[model samples]
Each structure stands twice: as C-alpha cells, then as structure tokens.
Target: MEKQLRKQVTALALYQIIGGILGILLTLWVMFRGELVLTQQVLRFSLFAAALFMFSILCGRMLFRNPPRGLVLSLLHQVLQVVYFTFGEYGFQYVAGLRIGFGFDMVGSWTFKFRVALSSFQFDFGNATGQKFIGINLVALFLIFWIERLLEQGKR
Candidate 1:
C-alpha cells in the first residue's frame, strides 16, 4: 500500500514538473518571438506552475510520513482537479463547457454544433491565451488518473 501511494504521488509530481518545464519553455519562446516582454498572464502561469511543483513535492513528503488510504487520496486528487479545472487559469465557464459539453448554450444547439463549439475551447482559450496552461494541466490530470487506475488494477 505504501508503494502504491508513493507511485500515485510520483505520478502527480511528474505532472507538476512536466507542466512547469513546459510553461517556462513556452513563455521563453513567446518572449523571444515577440517584444521580449513578460506579460502578467505569463508571469501568473509561471508562478502557478512553480507553486504546483512545490505542492507536489510537499504532498509526496507528507505521503511518505503518513500514507493516506487509496480511496481517500483518489478522492482528494479528483477534488483538486475539479477545483483547478473550474477556477484555475482558463476560468470556470470555459473549461466546464469544454469538458462536459452540458452547458446552458449546449442545451439548445444541434449536437454537431455543440460539439464543435465545445472543442473550440482548445484553440480559443477564451480571452486569455495563457489559460491554455490550465487546460493542458487538466488533460494531464485526466491521463494520470487513468494511468493510476490501470496500475491499481494491475496490483489486484
């Protein structure tokens, strides 16, 4: 059980680390391409990525000291992902519509049109392009959860 918990924590840590590296790289790339200015959005995303990396390390340490039950950790991860997706960089209204495809606007639209509109969020990122960082992180979380489930089943 401790090994499994450690594996889960490691998965989260990888997510954070990868996100941070990618965020930094993209920011630098944009700066080089444009006026070499660091906008507030870019700075916010960079800081958020750094914070996530730190949080991941802290969670790993805490798990080593006192491991949580698998279900509890899973629930906590899910809740955190939900909060991040809803209120993080991309903003609630946008990501929710992209993820669930059940927003108010979707109700009256044709199925195909709704799908297109929902998928558009991938490119739109609403008013803030930097919000794409959160959206990508959300996708990474989904993949991590799926991978974790697979690993758990393998153990069983």
Candidate 2:
C-alpha cells in the first residue's frame, strides 16, 4: 500500500473506532436515563445500534489488519449510512432511498453525526419530532474511492 493509502486507511479506522465507542456510550446513556421506555421497539433499536457499533469496530480492526477487506467493509458501511433506512414505533422499513451527487439525511429524535465534506466536520442536534435533516458526507464516499484508486495503482 502507498503511504497515502495507508494514512487514509488509518484515519478511517480511527474514525470508525471512535465513532463506535461514542455511539455505544450514547445509546447506553439513552437507555439508562429512561428517556424512552424499554419497549420491544426501543430494545430492538438499541440492540441493533450496539450491533452496528461493534461491527464498525470490527471493520476498523480489519482495516488495520487487511486493507482490501477493510476498504470493502468501510464502503459497505458508508453505503448503509447513505441508503434510505428508518426504524420507527409504527414499524421498521429499510428501503427506498439513495442520495448521489450531493448529500442529505433526515432523521428523528435519534441523533448521530451526519458526516459531510472531505476534510471537515459538521454536527447537528436533534430536538424535533418531525425534523428534516440535511447533511453532506462526501468524505466517506471520496475516501473509499481514493483508497480503491490507490490500491489499483499499486497493483499496476
């Protein structure tokens, strides 16, 4: 792997690890605090969140150990965040939505960082029930692209 590619992988790995830790912490806080009753829906959501965070940490570890697999996992993870997915009290639906060319996201009370920009940070808080979230996460998309390009170059 090239120096540039190595650095990007390291950065992504760190990001994933840190984000996973923070998410776990936040989910715990939300659960313990009793902000919402522990219903099947909420419990399911919490379990899913925890599982996803753990998966992210695993992806980060994989990235550090194996770039090819790591890059693919990271790409899948980012694609998941971009894809249209929703879990609500009424029911859970994970279909129908794709944002290409630009970035935008709409989420409810469950708040998380919607990464935007290649080398920058944008943070938004959630407070409204019916909120329309708009964000840009070109960073994840571009980083995976650049990493793949670098890997291809290295192969040649």
lDDT of 2 by residue, 29-102 (tens): 87899666897766777787777777777878898998888877876766545423322222221111122324
The runs of at least 3 residues in candidate 2 whose Cα sits more than 4 Å from the true structure, single-residue gaps closed, are: 84-136
Estimated TM-score per prediction? 0.37, 0.64
> Which consecutive 10 residues in model 1 have the weakest lDDT in total?
114-123
Tens-digit lDDT track of model 1 for 50-69: 44434433444444454444
Q: Supply candidate 1's per-residue lDDT for 116.
A: 17
TM-score between model 2 and native: 0.64
On the 0 to 100 scale, the lDDT of residue 122 in model 2 is 16
Clashing pairs for model 2 are 116-136
Q: Rate the local accuracy (lDDT) of all candidates.
A: 0.41, 0.57
